[model samples]
Structure formats: C-alpha cells, structure tokens
Target chain A: MSEKGIHIEEHRDDEASKLGMWLFIFTELLLFGGLFLVYSIYRWQYPVNFHEASLELSVTIGVINTIVLLFSSMTIAMALTAIQKNNKKLALRLIAVTLLMALIFLINKYFEWGHKFEHGLYPGSDLMALLERGHLLYFSLYFFMTGLHALHIIVGMILLIIAYFKVKKDSVNSDRFVFLENGALYWHLVDLIWIFLFPLMYLIT
Target chain B: MDHNKTHITEYKVLAKILLLLIFCTFLTISITSFNLAAFTVTIALLIAGVKGFLVLSYFMHLKYESLLLRILVGSIFLLFIIIVLITFIDYSFR
Candidate 1:
C-alpha cells in the first residue's frame, strides 16, 4: 500500500539489507547463547575446576587482543564517517587500518591458543592436565566456544578486507554503502562477542 | 549534509578516545589477575558495557539514526536481557 524510494518506486534493497543484517545478528546471538548455556552448566557443576582452568589462560594476551579490537572498531567508525563525507580515499585507508588490526588480533590469538595446545589443553583431547582435577568438560567448552568465536573473527576480517577493496574501487557510495555498513555491523558483533567472552572465560574466577 | 563534515573530525576524536578505553581495559584485566575481590567480574563487565555502548552508538551510527532503528535495536537488547534473566533464575534454583 505504501511506497518507499528515491523515485516513485521503493528502496526494497535498502530495507532488505538492514533486515537481513538484523536477522543474522539474531542467529548469532543464539549461536553464542548455546555456548553460554554449556559454559553455565559446566561452571555450576565444577566451580573449583573452572576456576583453576581459567588461570591457565593468558589474560595479558586477551587484554592485548581486546585493545587491538577496540582500535579496529574505532577505525571502522572512521571509515563510515569517511563514507558519509564521500571521501573514498580516507575510507579506504581506515578500512586498511581495520584489516591490519584484525590481523594483529589473530596473531595474538595464534600464540595464545598455541600455548594452550602445547601444554596439552585442547577440546575433547587432553584437558585433564589443564585443570586441577575435573574440568575436562569445562576446558573443552572453553576451547570449543572460543575456537568458534575466533573462526568468526577470521571470517569477519576477510569481509573487512573485501570492504576495503570495494570502497577503494568507488563501489561504495551513499546509494550503495549498505555493504560497508553491514560489514561494520558484522565486525561490531564480533567485538560484542569478545566483550562477553573476556569476562566469561577470563574473569569468572 | 555537506556541512556535517565537522562530524568527521568528531569521529576521529572518538577513535582516539577508544584507544584510551582500550588502555583502561588492559589495566582492568591486569589488575584483575592480581587477585582482586569478587568485584572483578562486575568491574570488567561494566567496562565492557561502556565499550559496547560506545560502539553501538558511535560506530554503528545509531546516534544519527531514526527512532525506528533505535527501537528495533533496543528491543533486541531488552529481549536478550530478559532471556538471560529468566534463564538465570531457573538455573539458580536448580
């Protein structure tokens, strides 16, 4: 009954894109919700073991990665501002910064996970040595949940890289900056996951 | 719209403020590791909530968006909290 658009027609594409991103965000919440439920069950069953297992994590590394992500979040905001200003060059530069920050985040995670792996702390493999007595399930969930989150981060980074190139080629504009905007939303979701993860996995002792 | 270029500079300043927030997060984590009280998780979550709001408002452009999108996003967050609250009550009783 109602029409929407720049001309006589409606901007179905714009509204659809926003709806899609929101729906994707809902699914992501549920995905992480499952992991959170598992974590909750495990912690309730074995609080002591969970406490001990948390000590094995390098908070130093986690904090560093958090800051790295925070900076990237800032860069992406700048990128969006550049887009609003129609400064494609500045937008591209900011996107490059975001991509670089993401790589650094992954690099830090590599060593963090690598350390745990070296110490025989993997999911469903050999977590007995990780905790004091009984937290195999706990550590397993930690790795599985965090591992899955890290995978999402990697995917998000690739998306940011694509956004960088797309913006560089003048493909992103006020009319079609939906891709860039949604990409930023996806990146922020990744950041939001870590915001919860940092406390749940690290500070819950 | 062209006159709003001033907001571009504001965005950069926010970026710098985010760097400071990161430093605060690092400090919070480091101090937490050194055997803080039961407030460690609370403090960490508070810092995180602040950071999340900053991103949601500034980075996601919610601040500049219409009330419709804001209501949408707010309802989602409200739903999330309600779900968590109800579940926590059930779990705690168990």
Candidate 2:
C-alpha cells in the first residue's frame, strides 16, 4: 500500500452540543433548587411573616413581568424556527423583540426593587433589622433569588445578542444553527425559572 | 447523519401555547384573590408547574429531543425532589 498522509478530523455534533447545554441547564436548576429549598424551610417556619412580606410585592408588576417573559420566550422560540427555515431577517427581528422584552423586564425589576429600597426592605437595613426573623428571611430570599434571576437575564440577553449578530453574519443559519437553538434554550430556562419565581414570590401570599 | 432535519414548530402552535400560558397566569392570579387558605400555595405551585412544563416542552423543545436528553432532564428533577423531600423531613421533625 502507498504511504498516505495522516488525516485529522474535527467533529461538530449538534446533538452532543445540545446535550452539553442541557447538562449545564440542569446544574443551574439545582443551583436555584438549593435556594428554593432554603426559602421553603424559612417559609414553613414563619408562614405569617412570609405572607406579610410577600404581600409587599406588587402583583401588577409581577404579572406584567410574567407576561413579558412569556412573550419573550415565544419570540425566541419563533426565532429559532425562523432561522431553521432560513429566514434570517425574520429570525433577527424575532431575537431583537426578545431582547427588547428582556430590557423591559429588567426596567420593571429596577422600579420594583427601587420601591422596596425606598421602604428599606433590603437585608441589613434598619427597617429590615426591626422586622421579625421570617420577614427578614423573606426579603433576603426575595433579593437573592430575584437578583440571581436578573443576572441570568443579563447573561441570556448577551448570549442572544451574540446569536443575533451570528445569525446576521450567516454563521448561525439553516445548515448550522445550533448556536441559535442553544441560545433559545437558555432564554427559555430563564422564563422557566420566572414561571416558578412569580407564583412563589408574589401569589402564594 | 441527517443533521439537517430540524423540527420547525408552526407559528400558530406557538401562539396557542402563549395564549394558554397567559390564561394560566390569569387563572393563578384570580385564584389567589379567593384566598384559598392552605390550598393557596399548593394551587399556585401547581399552576406554575404546568406553566413550567409548557415552557420546557414547547418553548425549550424538550418534547422534540431524544430519549436520553429527556431522561437526563427527568432525572435531574427527580433528584431535586428527593433532596427537597429529605430536607423537609428534617424540618418537619424540628
């Protein structure tokens, strides 16, 4: 047999990459899961205080944010569908809409958190110090959980922005659009967390 | 491998799912107004679970994924529930 040059191949398995993303998502779920466990324990111990503190949250703002996130999730999912169909323009527009919704969500969160700060509900504030242990824990978990969620929103937004430009550049297109799919999955996970957070924080009072 | 066979969900189906999610959100809020006492939290969490499922299945496209991925997600949730239950056992005793 004739001597042959060594051949090296680079593999790009979309399914395997998606599986990796799903695993990362599971770790995220457990991360928040631990926080939720703490919240549940505290809520169990101080139901009345938790109820009172939860009532301080604005149902209107929570509802608006929920709707906004749900709509954004829809838009991102639709964006993936658009890209898969080779409709790059539509995909970009959809992702832009999703990003806009994320901004709106953050703005609402800013106002909501600001209103709470105005009342000194944050942890370690004199007002908070005066509150009972349950109220203290409630506000503490509220800030922690929602703050972490907001941070994820910022991260997901950045991911989508990168995906947006990639789609525009044709790097993420019909033949190879795993980037958009993975980005959309992360965005939906954010929405999924909020789906639980909204009811747990605002409605159960 | 035919890696190009992407599943493209219909726009109408996505719209319908969105509408259903909105309806569920409204339902959760309306039920909260009734002050169902002990059931309030349970009901809220149940609705949220349903909403989460919709987002996972449709929005995240978990429904379209392979069995291995489904099992992996399911196992993670199962483990979370176990940990939560075990913690509750400790708290309930105290």
Candidate 3:
C-alpha cells in the first residue's frame, strides 16, 4: 500500500513474460522458415548451380563463425548459471565474453563479405547481373539470410547490454532475472538459426 | 519471484554440451569432403536439426520448462513443418 489514498500492488509474472518471449520466438522461427523454404525450393530447381555457388563460399570462415557463435552461446548460458548462484561478477565477465565473441563473429563476417565484394559478388553489382539465374538466386538468398541473421545478433547484443546493466543495478538479481533469461533465449535462438544456416550456406552441395 | 523452482544448470554441463555441439559441427564439415551425392545435403541438414534440438533443449532451458510450455513449443514446430510440407506438395504437383 502506498501513502496515496488509492493502493496498487506491484505486479510481476515471469512465466507470462517467458511465454511472451516464446511466442515471439515462434513467429521468428516461421519468418526464417519462409526463407528456408524458398532456399530449399530453389536448390531443388537448380542443384548444379547451387552446388557451384556453395563452392565459392569460404568454408574456413563459415566454420570459424560457427564455432565462435557456439562458444558464445555456452558463455551466455553459463552467465545465467552464475547469476543464479549469486555470482554477479562472474555473470558480468561471462556476458562480456559473449559480447567479445559476437564481435569476433562479425569481424570474420566482414572479411568474408569483403572478399566477396572485392570479386563483385554482392547483390546489384554489375558482376551479379551477369551471373546465371540460379547462381544469382543462391547468392541473393545467401546475402538476405545471413544479413538478417547479423541484424539479429546486433539486436541480441543490445538485449544483453540491457541485461548487463540491470544485473549491475541489482534490478535483475537471482530472484528476478527473467529479463536476462529472455535475452539469453534470444541469443540461443540466433545460434539455433546459425546451426542450420552455416551448413546450408557454406557446406553441402 | 518466478513460477517454477530455480534450477541452476552447472557450468560444467554447459561446457560439455558445447563440446558435443562442436563435435557435431566437425562431423558436418568432415562429411562435406566426401562426395555422398544427394545424401550429403540430407546428412548435413540432419546434423543441423540435431544441433538445433540441443540448443533448444539445453541452452534455451526448454527441457526445464513446464510441460505445457514444452507442448506449446513443440506444436509450433509441428505447425511450421506442416506448412512446409504443404507448400512443397503444392510446388511439386504444380
């Protein structure tokens, strides 16, 4: 009860909050699911061209980014464990590690995209206009999917940043860390998407 | 306070899961070296599906979540699969 005549209670619901996040996650899954369907249909329609284009991508960079994102997911998961145990410092450090890994993943992406750009492989480039229809579709899907994934990583970074500050302020302590949980959930979702993207975009035919 | 009792996953467990995930990734890369024909992409995607299950279950704490929540999540994936199948069926027939 407050000093004012009217009394209002503080409301908090973690399950509902988490449910909300999961619902959003479902929507996100289908959004990418649509893209995956398009990719699969095209790969079916033009297997030879898809195989050749997949060969052009750098497997080394794709593998490195895969490992980096996996490591970051582990760190973020452990950060929640740390927070659960009331180890704020360790949680902070773990989140920092995750942020660093994200930067490393982006840096690798920069080099990879930079190399492709140097060869005029990006969308709308003169060289792209001259490529076969199938190859063009492959690269177009490549850019759109990976570019959207990168944007997600940036958004996850922002959520983590907010969670970091909240943790520091003790607003999201051991008892109330749903914000952190949701952020970590988002991060894991990003990693989940990459698990499939890495192979589809870089490996196989 | 949260609804369920707090279940703090061990750091070591997360590390182990990470190791397993990395091993799966290596397997994915290793298989690409061999010319398995059309089976190659199938294997790659299968491995990816397994890896995705791990991330969803362990990393995302879906396993620890309430049964209702788990069912809801599973149903969403099921719905997505059904849509994909219908789309494919339509495309292939057309």
Candidate 4:
C-alpha cells in the first residue's frame, strides 16, 4: 500500500503547515502579552485617569475598522474556498479585494492617528494637557497596541497580494491550496487580535 | 462525490454567516453608543467571540479536522490568553 502511504504523508504535510501557523500565532499572543502587562499596571495604578483618557478615542473609527477587518476575513475565506473549488479567477479576485480592503483600513487608521497628532495628543507630547490623566495612559496603550496590530495587517496584506498574483498566474492550483489556506489563517489571526483590542481600547467602562 | 455541489453549498452558507456577523457587529456598536458602557462592552465582546467561533469552525474548517488537532490548537490559544490575563492581573494587583 505504497499509495496509501503517500496519501498519509500528504495529509501530514498539511497538518504540519497548520501546526506551524498555530505556533506562530502563539508567539504573536506572547508578543502582545508584554503590552498587556504594561497596560494593566498602568490602568491599575490610575483607573480613573485611564477611563477618562479612553473617552478621547473615537468608537466610530474603531467600529469601522472592526467591520473592515471582519470583511477582510470573509474575503480571505472566499479566496480559499475559490481555490479549493479550482476557481482560480474567483480566487484572484477575492484576494485582490482583501488586499484593497486592508489598504483602506490602513488609510482610516492613519487619518484617525493624524487627527490626534495634530491636536498634540501624541505620546510624549501634549497628550496630558489635551485629556485627563487617566485618559492619557489609556490612549497611549491604544496607540501602541493598535499600531502594532496595524503593522501585522500590513504584513498580512503583502502576503495576500503575493498570493493573489501567484494564483493569477496559475502558480497555485486546486491540488495546492496551501498558500491560500495559510494566508487566510494569518488574516483570521489579525481579526482575532482586533476582536480583543476593540474591547480593551474602546469598550472599558 | 459531487465535489461541485458540496463546494457551492459550503461557500453559500459561509457567506450568509459572515453577513450575519457583520450585522451583529453593527448592532453592538449602535447599542453601545447609547451610554450603556458595561453592557455594551460585554455584549460587544460576546458577539465578537461568537463571530470568532464561527470563523474557526466553519471558515477555517476546524470542525472537519481531527479531535486531537482541535484540542491542541484550542488549548494553545486558551493558554496564551490565560498567560496574558495572569500577567495583567499580577501587575494590576501589585
């Protein structure tokens, strides 16, 4: 049953890829772990200050970004599904859409941050004067955490763009949907990170 | 093994579920803006958790995967979250 053996090996490779991604995701969590520790210490020491600072953030922006990320997640899924079904054209289109949406997300974040910076609300700037003591700490954490998360989104977009072109050139076929699958997994991780950040940054009472 | 039929059905269902999640997100935002701070955050996170579950189970194909693999991944994710919370709590408490 040499053929059966080969089949098993193929399956194992897929599992290995998934396992590798999972490990990377775990590392990502730890990366954010350090930030979470910093936030809690600051927040604990000055709860009232942080609460007041939190109000400066625009919930509308956070909500819109959440929607953008969620929509990107959907597009990535559709891309993978397209590849699985051997619809290369569809896959390419979906990946392109995802990349575009990611670009829009970055644009939105830039404007939001720019507004704050213009108002002298930047870190180590006049943030203390523009908002309450608690709020400054909260905004600082928001900027740092969300800035890091935004970087991840940028990286994910680059990966997806590369995958899109590869799929466009028929470089990745239905028999080899691993690229799209992994790309989607990365996007989902980005989405997961935002899901947590949204509440921590914008929803604390 | 009608691959075409199965693929179509899966894609359709996934799309519908994602749309519903998007709607839920909008609803959460709308409800929270009314000054219900405690309920808003909790409900928003609860909805987000639900949405994440759907992505993992349906879109990511975790449901069709092996139980061992599922447990392995789930435990790792949960462990990471625990580590984060614990460190945060330690700092906050200190």
CA lDDT of each prediction against the hidden true structure = 0.76, 0.91, 0.92, 0.76
**CAPRI-style class, candidate 2:** high
Better of 3 and 4 by lDDT: 3
Candidates in order, TM-scores: namely: 0.84, 0.95, 0.96, 0.83
Record all residue pairs in model 2 with backbone atoms less than 3 Å apart, i.e. clashing: none
lDDT of 3 at A119: 92
Candidate 1's residue-wise lDDT over A95-119, tens digit each? 9889888899889888988887787
Candidate 2 C-alpha error for residue B2, in Å: 1.8
* Model 4, span A22-139: residue lDDT tens: 6787788678867866786676677667666677778888888888888888888888888888888888888888898899899999999999889887778855556665676677
**Highest DockQ: which candidate?**
2
Count of backbone clashes for each model?
1, 0, 0, 4
Which pairs clash inside model 3? none
Candidate 2 lDDT tens digits, B1-94:
6667767898888999999999999999998888778898899988998998888889888788788888889898899989999999987888
Error of 2 at A69 (Å): 0.3
The CAPRI category of model 1 is acceptable
| Docking class of predicted structure 3 | medium
The order by descending TM-score is: 3, 2, 1, 4
Residue-level lDDT tens digits of model 2 in A1-205:
2358666555789988888899899999999999999998888888888888898999999999999999999999999889888898999999999999999999999999999899777867899888888888998899999999999999999999999999989999988989989999999999999998998899756
Q: Write the per-residue lDDT of candidate 3 for residues B4-60, one digit (tens) a residue.
A: 496788998899999999999999999978989999998998999899989988899
- lDDT-wise, the better of 1 and 4 is 4
